[model samples]
Target: MFAPTFNLNLTLRRAVLAALLAAGSSVAMADPLHYHVEIDTSQFSGAGFLDFAFLAGNSPAPGATATLSQFSGAFGALDSKEGNVSGSAPGTLVFGNGGGYNDWFQNVSLGGRFAFDIVFGGDFLGTNGNVGTTFSLGLLDQSASAYLGNPNGNLLQFDLMPLNGALPASIAASTYASIASISAVPEASEWMMLTGGLALIGFALRRRRVAALTA
Candidate 1:
């Protein structure tokens, strides 16, 4: 009878093309996130050299200014004997000079550490669906009017969201502490499209069991 309806329409079109290749390999498997920013300063007594600026806002609301241009240029040049301080924009970070000694707080000893790498998906956490979304970190010193006031004490703020199910990796800011690490590998072309969709549904069920054993 038409070869049993052409083998049941070729096994329902190879099981609907293996469920659309496993739903496009789970939407191209995207999960990569690593961010670390540590600036403890060992209790920071502050003697000279304290210019910290790392601002990023998406409306957590607490003086949300918003300026995180994908970590701008990724902190390239700034070698105060390799202590580092050269950030005009792009999540700047400059806490005390290294060795240059400019006069406006560059005497050294402000504490260290600054690392950056981001990939949180969803257009970088815009949260269109709105399960959760909020990122705010504003710490400003920039010499605070030459230290007449606000001497790098009461300004450091952080309001990163995402809990329980996990997101807000880590952040501790009195002087500085931000650690966000998330890695969910599956790249290699999504494992070759999930092994070529299970080898095309195992070659279409072994060619429909050899065409039903030669009918």
Candidate 2:
């Protein structure tokens, strides 16, 4: 006599639950930290080539800063300009830093003008100087373009001058360095949602199976 096959639905249920739990355990809203870089040149190319690194457990909060090793460009020169820095819109398909932060690090349209705000704790120009330059970085325009990949948004651009009207003494030095190194941890809520969804699916499936058997 031939043996009967065992039910396969139970195994499927367990596998689905496991996957949902895994996904749910890793959901957290990324906190955003902003760092602005001043572009030195009127126009340049390959600004995105700068090496970026992020460490784990870094808070996306104010007073947190990132240190860049160096700034290099494809044109063999530090093709950056001086301008006040803040961050772009976070978590967007266009002009976003791939992760959960809002920095204008990607998809910049050259020769286009935009405005931004910068908040400094003290004198960014120097420690001894008291040139309280606290205002919006006005006329913040992309004076030039460099690359042609990832559409018009992925192109990078910068300011022709730090403040536009006049050059600040801090133009030579970067007001904000590239904090390319940071990381974010997942929150507990994600896991709960995933588990909850899986449980509901399992219950519905089991009920259907029972109904079928009775019918």
Candidate 3:
């Protein structure tokens, strides 16, 4: 009777460990997402200041908001916008310039309408180049002014999402269109750690069982 109970307990423990391993692995994976973040800043113009900017690297908590980071130091990704959609103006947009990053309304305004495309990439070179599966996008307000100014101040934010879901949109009063996105997955190192732990546990259990049999 004692031997039977001991065997049953060992079996139960092994089953529990396997279940936990499976659960942990599943929770850590969620394929990275791709996105198309389109915005309409036509109603306004940021002539002297950047109307928007974004932090690139993936973060620990990637929900529904653009994570904030400095312009110079970071890695994994780099947030950037394409050319001016304002009808006529070449090479007007500045990226990580004058020291790091910059942009303006003139770069995105088109006659009376403004539109631009930006890949909300983060600079992943600092102390944290860690990557995840989701993206954080941020829109600029003004150079302490709006409706039309040199620079934008306030930051409108969004989390974005899974690759196949719906694209997120933005703009305080204007319009926006999106197409879900992300870039995060569990590291190989984490898997190695898990494997090591399981091996040790199993070895210890086996030794205990042998000692019991000998006694």
lDDT of each: 0.36, 0.30, 0.34
lDDT of 1 by residue, 1-215 (tens): 22464765676587667657654553322222323333333343343343333333333312111122233211333223222224333444332212222111223333233233322322323222212223223222334344312333432333332232334322232322332222233546656766776776676777767767777
Our tally of clashes for model 1 stands at: 2
Residue 33's lDDT in candidate 2: 19
Model 2, span 35-62: residue lDDT tens: 2433332343222322112111222211
Whichever of 1 and 3 has more lDDT, that candidate is: 1
Candidates sorted by TM-score, best first:
1, 3, 2
- At residue 170, candidate 1 shows an lDDT of 26
Best by lDDT: 1
Name the regions of candidate 2 deviating beyond 4 angstroms: 1-48, 51-145, 148-188
Q: What digit string (tens of lDDT, one per residue) describes model 3 on residues 85-166?
A: 2222232222331112222333231223222333332222111222322222333333424433212323233333322323
The per-candidate count of clashes, in order, stands at 2, 21, 42
